[model samples]
Structure formats: structure tokens, C-alpha cells
Target: MLSRTPKMLLQTPGARRGFHSIMSSLVPMVLEQSPRGERVFDIYSRLLKERIVFVHGPVNDDMASLVTAQLLFLESENPDKDVYMYINSPGGIVSSGLAIYDTMQYIQPKVNTLCMGQAASMGSLLLAGGAPGCRSALPNARIMIHQPSGGAQGMASDIAIQAEEIIKLRTRLNGLYASHTGKPLKVIEQAMDRDLFMDPREAQEFGIVDSIIANRKAPQSSGKQ
Candidate 1:
């Protein structure tokens, strides 16, 4: 499991300005190595081989951008291995979600998603992008799906453009559901219209996931041969 150093800062653009100032004011810390003694290592050094990256928080453009970058880095570093994504998001911007989905699909890694909390709206779509043998949620986790939503300003033509974009987003989302559930497109569309929400068991029953992995163990190989 790969571990990364935690860096905390308020995520919103307005809030980040204060964090930037605070960081700039701090003097950097420096530590010197002992040059003459036997070498010593810390826990992080001993645990470098097994790493699990944690990407927890709201789904926004900044988060999406960072996730995409990390996915690219992981793909480059480990081209043949599966990348586990533990998602617990209440969902956010549709476009941001699409950006993440596109990156995940393009990387083509076997993505195993563990939905520990909630995977709703756009988050559900991202979960659906996982590879065929991907794992699913813990017992209490939930997954939800619905039509795309957006806000608009300005003229009537702008509204029309936004509407068209929403339609396209819905079509893309429906396609994902259809592929994952092996359901007809029309049926998936109807389900999306219903604003479907399912717990782990229900989701698994409907073919939304392979199984409910409550123990959080490594996903077993499906042995498709």
C-alpha cells in the first residue's frame, strides 16, 4: 500500500488564498543526517513497498485534476497492475466527474473501487468505470444514479446550450449503466429518471457490482481463463 504525506489546505479558491499566505510566511524545516553513524530508517522507509493512496474529499475541479494526475502517475509506474480507488463522495459537478471518468477510462487500469460510504450521482458514474473484475462496496455503503444537472446564466441560447449538454451527459451516464448492468439502454434511461439508489446488497443483486466486499480484503482473482 502506497502512502502519501498529508497536506491540508482549504479547498475552495477563496479559502486557498489564506492558506497560500500562511504557507509563505512559514520558514521551511531542515533536518541533517548523521554522517558518521550507522544508517537508521523510519517506519515510512520500511513500508515503502505496500502503498494505498487516499483521495478523500469533495468532488470538484481541483480534486478531479489532482486525481487525474495521480492516475496518470500510477499508470506510468505500474502499467500491468490494478489500481484500487476507494471512493466516498456525495458527488459534485458533472463536468468534473466526466473529467475523472475520462481519465480513468483512458488509463485502462483495472480499477477496483471500494465504496465505504456513499457513491452518489456523479460518483456512481465514476465507480461504474471500473474494470470488469472490479470489486464493490462494504455492507453499509450506498450507490446512486440520476440525470445530469447544471446551472446556467445569460441568454436563451445559453440555456439551450446547457440543456443540450445535460442531454449528452445523461446519454453518456446511461451508456455506463447499460454497460455495467448489461441492461438495455432504454431500461437504464428509465432507471436514471427514477433517481435510483441502492445499498450494497441491492446493487449487487441488480448486477451493478460483482459482490459486496465487507471485509475489505484484496479482491480475489476471477480467473477468467
Candidate 2:
């Protein structure tokens, strides 16, 4: 019995070329690993061709750079297609998260952000920042939002400047959340005063997610949602 060829291999010529490029990049890794690496490489290539991006770790400079590049590349490849971003992060540096968020907004393609586990702090902001009506969370996913946190250790004058900057970041982030969720700025600010956590349903109510994904009877046939 012959194994079935991947759908990507059967799609448009463009997809085949994209898949080939993905495989080419993974060749070095495949050469250095066991057979399992091949399997991993295959899955990763499929995901890339499917236009799925993952954010499964902390939001840092490296993650920002890679994700930004992927978003731009996908947009260049097909500006009309929707991009899927699956996020499961505890959140990290504000600057790094902003870089990704800015790119998401800058791209022509609609970004469908799916929360798999927890989207907290800056992570929650990114979740809310997805294209309107495209943000979603799994049934058991949790979401959180809070004011940006930072520490300052220096002379009184320098510490004061740092404190001012932190306040500015908090204000900017609060404004963004309010704009995305259509909530009052004061309401968003109050919610962010502490670590406010919510499940999928609550996140929907809070406007962090437009919907909670339900079980599908069949595999997803399109990237619209």
C-alpha cells in the first residue's frame, strides 16, 4: 500500500514551489538528525504551506524577528490569503511583542489568532489585536490582561525617568486594548490594574476573542476562520 501524497503536493504549482523551498531550508537539520527529524521537518513544511505560524514560547526579540519575517513573506506570496497564528505564550518583553503586533497590523492578509493554551499580558494584547472577528480561543484556553510591569534601579532622577516610561507604556497598551475590545479606556485600565484572568467564554465577553472554537465535524477545509 502506497502512502498518500500530501495535499500541498497536489495543490497549485505555487504551493509546490513553496513546499520545496521549505524543505530545502530544513535539509541541513535533516542531515544532522535521526529519522524523527524528517517527520518533524515534513510536518513543519506542511504547516508553513498551510500558512500557519506558531508562537509557543516567550515573546522575545528572536521570536519577533522570525514571526515578522514569516508574516511579510506570506503576504508577499499571497496577499489575498488569510494567515493563521496559533499562540501559547506567557508573554515577555513589551518591545518584542509590539514588533509582532505591528507586523500583524501592517500585513495585508487577515491574521486569525488562535489561543491554544494561555495568552497572558502582552500575549493577551496580541490575541485581541488580531483582525476583527478572526480572533478565537479553544474551549479550555485561558486569557489574561494586566498593566505592563518593569523595575528601575538607579539614582532617583534616572529611576524617575524609567517610571515615567513605564507609565507611558501602560497607558499606550491600555489604549490599544480599549480600542480593540471597544471598551472604555477607563474600564480597560481598571481591568489591567491587576492580573485579570478569563476562560474562553469570558475572553469572548471581554472582547479579547471574537469566538470560542467549537468541535468541527470535519477537518477545516479553508483558512477563513
Q: Which structure among the candidates has the greatest lDDT?
A: 2
After best superposition, candidate 1 residue 182: deviation in angstroms? 1.1
Clashing pairs in 2: none
TM-score of each: 0.73, 0.78
Evaluate residue 136 in candidate 1 and report its C-alpha lDDT on the 0 to 100 scale.
78
Best by TM-score: 2
Give the per-residue Cα lDDT of candidate 2 at 176: 93
- Per residue, candidate 1 scores C-alpha lDDT tens digits across 1-225 of 433322211122222222123324644443335667555444322222232333344566676776787777778878777777777766776666778878878885677667778777767776767776585777788888777666655567766776776677778778987988788999888888856889877777666767677474754232134
Question: Mind giving the per-residue lDDT tens digits that candidate 2 earns over 1-225?
Answer: 543321100011111122223334644322235566634345544677789987766676677788899999999999999999998877777888899999999999999999998888778888999999889888888888878766666567766777787888888998999999999999998998887889987888888888877664422222344
In model 1, the worst 10-residue window by lDDT is: 5-14
TM-score for model 2?
A: 0.78
Decoy 1 TM-score against native: 0.73
Candidate 2 achieves a global lDDT of 0.77
Error of 1 at 210 (Å): 1.1
